[model samples]
Target: MWRRVTSLSHLLSSPKSSPQLTPTSYGPKIWETLSTEVSKKSGGGIFSKERSPFITFVLGGPGSGKGTQCSRIVETYGFTHLSAGDLLRKEITMNSENGAMILDTIAKGKIVPSEVTIKLIRKAIESAENDKFLIDGFPRTEENRIAYERIIGAEPNIVLFFDCPEEVMVKRVLSRNEGRVDDNIDTVKERLKAFRSLNLPVINHYSNKGVLYKIDGTGTEDEIFERVRAVFDAWK
Candidate 1:
């Protein structure tokens, strides 16, 4: 998924787990205040001196286990897990005006606009009480990346790319049974095409910045996470 980037159509599974729901050390009151503060502030507003959270961007093909590994990471490292796909799905569920548009976009295996995805992420960050975050399956395009930096006034501290083969990714997605809008064969193929044309440049950008950690994602979940844990260990 990460290396050759020839195809990534299979990584588009429904995100079944969310680390964002995990409990935080901060109380509800703290979260309430934090949410208020974040809501009032626009992206790139003032407070340039304010430090953002420790963010780790997890990138992979649709079936590369980004969601599964994020759950493990949250348990082990106490980072809030925020899946961009989940956030977009939530917007759909809430019947937001943008919901239909988002659904159509995903159904076609095209990326939702950066503004929409970034807004959801910014809200999640503002509401979160944790200082560390594992933002999964996001910044899918260079526009997405630049929008995040411009609006959030922060860049990810680390980027983890799951390097699974296209064949492996395709098999996993085919068997995922996630009931996702984009899980069909045709959509998956388009998503793979989008991954190469849209997402790879973002990955290359992060790699050049020296914060990208490429992990072999061909093994069982536990085995892959062992590698993931080692990366975190080294970071610590």
Candidate 2:
């Protein structure tokens, strides 16, 4: 059922190009059209007011420990963990229609199109039985944030920004042998550059919206989770 609704048939025939790394590469018209089609097919948006889940956007640079903390949150609080990166990686491994595109974008340390990422996220949310969700490594750009709001027709309940030093983040990424294509020094540097140039604005936007929690990510795993735990506990 989900496969039929979330199929990438529309994008499969798209011209092959190194996806532009800029935030405004795709216009609002595209999102509006896709959103409308999705809404019509689903009978409504994926989320409705009464059933709207508790959503926390977990954000951080590479190796900022957001993933580890998300695991802790799921264990302690029972929120369903949804890592956008993991979802995209699964697409690549499964050789889905969007696999090659997503692989190229990630290798270049660029973001996948909001349309593709958002559909994957929506499918995950719809399939899950849990109401509360921890969405990690998403909305890496203002465009991503806007597209999500426009398509999902809802805003995250809170946004978590794991604040960590560049030096610390780099050191951690270099040491952690995750065997990911983007884990190399060059790719990690590129990811940091993209993060600073793109992700920070999304953080500031959420901060201005008063839903952003800036957590100090420079500590032992337990220490950082404690800070993250406090934020979730308050929301609880």
Candidate 3:
């Protein structure tokens, strides 16, 4: 198992001392109340000292090959792969209660509520038997980052940010033909805008925390995975 090196000081600190999260007009009181109830029922968090998992938050803009790299990591390192996007999409497919909300949010290239996304993620992690996990395309905003930390009661062991150029990412997405609703030019542009405005801060936050590994996201799939392999291998 990978060792946890991040200090508990921040994880255990009072909310006031934590980094100030971006304010949103979403119903914060309702979310916090629900999150607290869920956390309490889940034994203070999805993880405990005895069952803490090795988590790697895989971050990148759309078509940055984060999903591709996550698959390779899971195959090579025995870590379970969980894509937040995939989970939300699954909810849409199942026509769950949040299906309409998630679909509309995704279609507009807006983020789903942290409360909803975090619940799905927590459920996925709890159901998996693996002690190592690669959570791809997550913590897309500072709100996401904070909500996760508050509800999960732990920090990722490491974070991987795939740095790819926007032009390259757009070309790759357009040609990949994934049939995703947000793969077209307009949505891709919106997603990129969202990435810059929201995701970059989360990336910088991890970098500041000293647990982020940035990998070159150019070139062939094999080439990119090679760079990713070096990071995971070192962790091993």
What TM-score, computed on C-alpha atoms, does each candidate reach? 0.79, 0.81, 0.83
* Cα-based lDDT for every prediction: 0.75, 0.77, 0.79
Consecutive 10-residue window with the lowest summed lDDT within model 2: 1-10
Error of 1 at 82 (Å): 0.6
lDDT of 2 by residue, 1-236 (tens): 00011111212122221111112234335534533454453346565433445678999999888898899999998989999999999999999999999999999988899999999999999998897799999999999999998888777767777888899999998998888989999999999999999997898778677567677788799978777766655433
Best by lDDT: 3
Residue 34 of model 2 has an lDDT of 38
RMSD of model 1 against the true structure = 10.1
**lDDT comparing candidate 3 with the true structure:** 0.79
Backbone clashes counted, model 3: 0
Per-residue alpha-carbon lDDT of candidate 3 for residues 1-236, written as tens digits (9 for 90 to 100)? 33323322232123112122222243335434433444444475566534656778999999999999898898899999999999999999999999999999999999999999999989998888887888999999999999998888777778888888899999999999989998899999999999989997898788778677777788888988887776766555
Mind giving the per-residue lDDT tens digits that candidate 1 earns over 113-213?
99999899988887877768889999999999999878886667678888777788888888999888888888878888888788888888887775676
Q: lDDT score, residue 15, model 3?
A: 19
